[model samples]
Target chain A: MGLLKKRKREGGEIPTASMADIAFLLLIFFLVTTTIDVDTGIGMVLPPKLEDDVEPPPIKERNVLKILVNETGQVLVEDQPSAIRLIRDEVKKHVLNEGVDPRYSEAPGKALVSIKTARQTPYDAYVGVLDEVWMAYFDMWDSEARRLGFPDYATYSAAVAEQGAENQIRDKIKAAISIAEPDKQ
Target chain B: MASSHFKKKTSVKQEIPTASLPDIIFMLLIFFMVTTVLRETTVQVRTTLPQAEALTKIDQKRLVSYIYIGPKKLDGNRLGETGVQIDDALVEDMGSVRTIMYRKLIEQPKLIVSLKVDQTSEMGIVLDVQQELREAGALRINYSSKREIPS
Candidate 1:
């Protein structure tokens, strides 16, 4: 017999280490491409705990000039038809005139305007109304402060005096504006 | 002697080397599997949202309270009014909602109190909820809506 055999084993299996790496790469690719979801909302201030022993402020019921927005986007102020665009001016007028009276001028922060919006109303509409309320509040407060001879009086005084020959009218406007400012809690 | 030594000389066997492709592929798969993060779906109530031209994204993690608005159920029939549905009861009065929201706010100062209202629900119902949220000192209020695709 010959020392070496003529026939030899053919087609031996080859080992592969690439499968794990491919799987890992694919997993990484999918993870990097996926997206996450988030929620949205307006800013809020929460009340403190009842157990804190801090005495609660006395509740005073003040008329909050209500602005109601229905599902169809109709704006109603005190049960009257009002345009959405004109809400700021209308609210200003209401806060300064109807919501406040001269008898309550000593207690200017008592008047409040509560904006009641429908849940189904669009976010844009809600924010729009809030912006209007903020503007009206600021305008009314500034005018009132000017009439009362507070610091930075010249700018507000000039704006009020520019209305002309209506000193009584100006005083009434001042009183109305004073009540429009919300009381800080 | 020369004829006896003339035996056939066999050629040496040559071995071919294989590229280490399997090792590379296996490592890539493992890396991806280890790095991938799995996401779980959260339970959400269905509500139709109003469309807007400009909607900004909020990223802060917040405690949200759900408020549902649907028809009032009287007897066995559902009453169709745009009112708040709290704990299986229709809240016709706004004060009750305000009081509850205020209590919740006091309990959790950082709560957001999101409103989930059906699309067909009346604007008045939604507004009432918002007014209550504001009065309760819940300043951070947000509306839940389906994200619109930019076509």
Candidate 2:
């Protein structure tokens, strides 16, 4: 009778000995498939489509700094042949002139940096010129941030961001960069 | 008596407690699962991005749409003509870029088009694509580039 009762009684609990193996399998699969790389790059905003009937606003010749990159990868700052290394200083002087120079901008807020590239210009060359221009603006912003009692521009911007305050530096020193279209090939 | 007590202590079996093994594995699995992106698209073009110093990171990845412009990769380590790739397909006609981008803009108005162009490629194709993007009203763009190693 005892032997029969023992045979009738089944195992009290379901098997969990294989759970660790199953979890290990899933962990291995996920570990093999994970990718942690982040995408980084330069950001820009393109102007919207212009209607045929709308006329473009006119910017003064003196306030606009013309930068041209030709097919040979040569850079021309204000129609004068220049090297890529000189663009940053030239851009800074032009933007920060504050009416001291006759050929430079009237004010930082009104200054315009126009970049025009040829159809055959290498993409890297164009990017190099653009990077210099942006670096000039960043330098100006940093000085402005320091004048306003901050260690650097990034810190000022971050502090302002945390407080939900308007960025006065950006408003005062606007980066008014315009990308001009190249002539048709 | 001391010898008997020492023998009694040595008689007990020693084994590692592994009852929490599944929980530990599950934690690791969750971590990997959260970070995984599952390798979606197979890029057909070779985008050797240009290097630059002025760079900004796009934090919101969901708002990004990629446009790859580079030489078409062919068989046996050869590169063909310059091609434009959107998603997994290569765009044959340049004019269709406007329509395709316009449709994308309709779905996500804040779509930021990330242009991944090869370093040696000319500006002609890049501008053409920009023109198409302007027409499509997807104005926000990112020029994908590597950070310049400071010399």
Candidate 3:
């Protein structure tokens, strides 16, 4: 019976001479049709458009840190010629305030970083400065989590394991970086 | 005892089995075909995106629209001007950007306008585009960028 079954299986050897053609054709089709660009970005939510002209509330001068980027991509922090790398430290200092300078904010909740860019500023400079400011907030959050008894937060998944403690802090002290309207050239 | 009894000599030709080669290749081909996404539009602007470390990846492709701003392709025939491309066509004026994007937002209310600008492009042109988008009520913007600076 086993011999009969084996004989029947080998009775007809199917031809595969055109197998390469079929495979090549399918491969070519996919190669031609494939769009492999993996899109990623930095998402930002713009404040909703004003419904009508109303008296905008005035912000205290102490709480606002003005960062100006010029046409030649020079960054100025409160009238100081600041390097792109220093924006993070400057932002950290201002946001935390830490009772160091009364000119800066009193607390993270009160601090607002206003970035005003000239029309001709290079897009690279704009994004570079923005990135540094965000990094400052992120670094603060990391340390904040670690300071709250999660020693392994930065290295291990300690904060995440604590069930929303770190995320709560992140939500409370969101980066309040605002983009002011540009000066028309 | 059964193995010894079944060990009768038989004459058969030894050959490499090539019959299943096509089947294996065809399976791989099918995988590639299933994974491929067709390109919907051809890009006209020459853009090399800037790099940033703090990037947030959007999960849904359906809720996104792309805006390409850069110098016209420096290679072949040059337009001699920076161009803005939205949905496969070069925008002639800044005003039209609002109308076209307003129509897109009508279709997908949760649509996110992704701005892909060249690194060296002036911020003026970009701010103009942003103003148009704001006027169109497309407030959600994603600045498309690479994850690392190329060394």
Candidate 4:
């Protein structure tokens, strides 16, 4: 039995524990560095939930202007197919034509513009429309401010000179031009 | 005479041990390869998205809507028997679809409506969809595209 045991002795044993540690370290390193992907889609501001059934304030008929985008990407303002370049002017005309009422003059939430676009439209087209709408909002606000004997530009320099801080005035203007349009895409 | 008879004795022996490392590594590699989840192509619409130098990463998981523009057909035949399809859908007439979207938005305020449009689709169609979203009060929107691989 002693002779057989001596014969069974061989070379040094392999280091499996060290190899396992190295492999585990490598796995953890890769896991830490790998990036997880996210999906891209539309962005929108959601309306706040109402606890009680409070009747929404009545909106003036002329204050609401509707802009439409078809599957072919043509912008129609009140059923007329208008060129993309002309949309700003058209929107301005609509806003100006609708005289400001006491409700809207004191509060900005009264004026609302509805914009509707088709699902088949491209992203560039949608962005263009949004840019025009935003421009229209600013233009209308500036026009109203100028008529009210305020400065034409609503920048910080002008606001600081006229009022203590422009932030309150800016908020007032933004509140006046509430975007009521909902995106369907 | 006794001293001449006593010569030194010698023993000869050899042994071999099995190397199990390579076998174990090979099996582990095969197991991981089989179990690893492969990245799948996400969007269903077939489109060649426009390239951008800088793109913001998006994280929100929401339902994405897709639109395809190809040759228009009447009764399974191209309009006017012509192979070319013209984009004719108008933006103002999308009230029905808008109502549906409004309902969706009311249900999940965080939902993002993605537009996957074909490269060949006219710019007019794309614009129409965007306008509709804006009208629906959707403020957050993002476009989908594949990251370009450097050659």
- TM per prediction: 0.39, 0.90, 0.79, 0.37
Give the candidates in order of TM-score, highest first. Answer: 2, 3, 1, 4
- Predicted model with the maximum TM-score: 2
Better of 3 and 4 by DockQ: 3
Q: Write the per-residue lDDT of candidate 3 for residues A1-185, one digit (tens) a residue.
A: 99877977888655568768878887988978876666777777776666677766788898889999998888899988989999999998898885569889877787889999988889999999888887788788778767766653244244465654445555646688888879755
- Which residues of candidate 2, in runs, are more than 4 Å off? A1-14, B1-16
Candidate 2, residue A107: lDDT: 94
DockQ of model 4, rounded to 2 decimals: 0.12
Q: Model 3, range B51-87, lDDT digits (tens) per residue?
A: 9987778766778899999988756666457899998
What tens-digit string does per-residue lDDT give for candidate 1 at A2-37? 423323244444334555565556756765754446
DockQ of each: 0.17, 0.75, 0.54, 0.12
> For residues B53-127, what per-residue lDDT tens digits would candidate 4 score against the true structure?
223345434344333333333454333211111122312354544665567778888656655444445544454
Per-model RMSD to reference: 16.3, 3.4, 5.5, 15.4
Query: Which of 2 and 4 is the better model by TM-score?
Result: 2
What lDDT does candidate 1 reach at residue A133?
A: 60
Better of 2 and 3 by TM-score: 2
lDDT, candidate 2, at B118 = 97
**Clash count of each predicted structure:** 35, 0, 1, 39
Give the lDDT of residue A175 in candidate 1.
23
Which docking band does candidate 4 fall into?
A: incorrect
lDDT of 2 by residue, A34-120 (tens): 766677888889999999999988889999999999998999999999999899999999999999999999999999999999988
True contacts kept of each: 0.32, 0.87, 0.80, 0.22
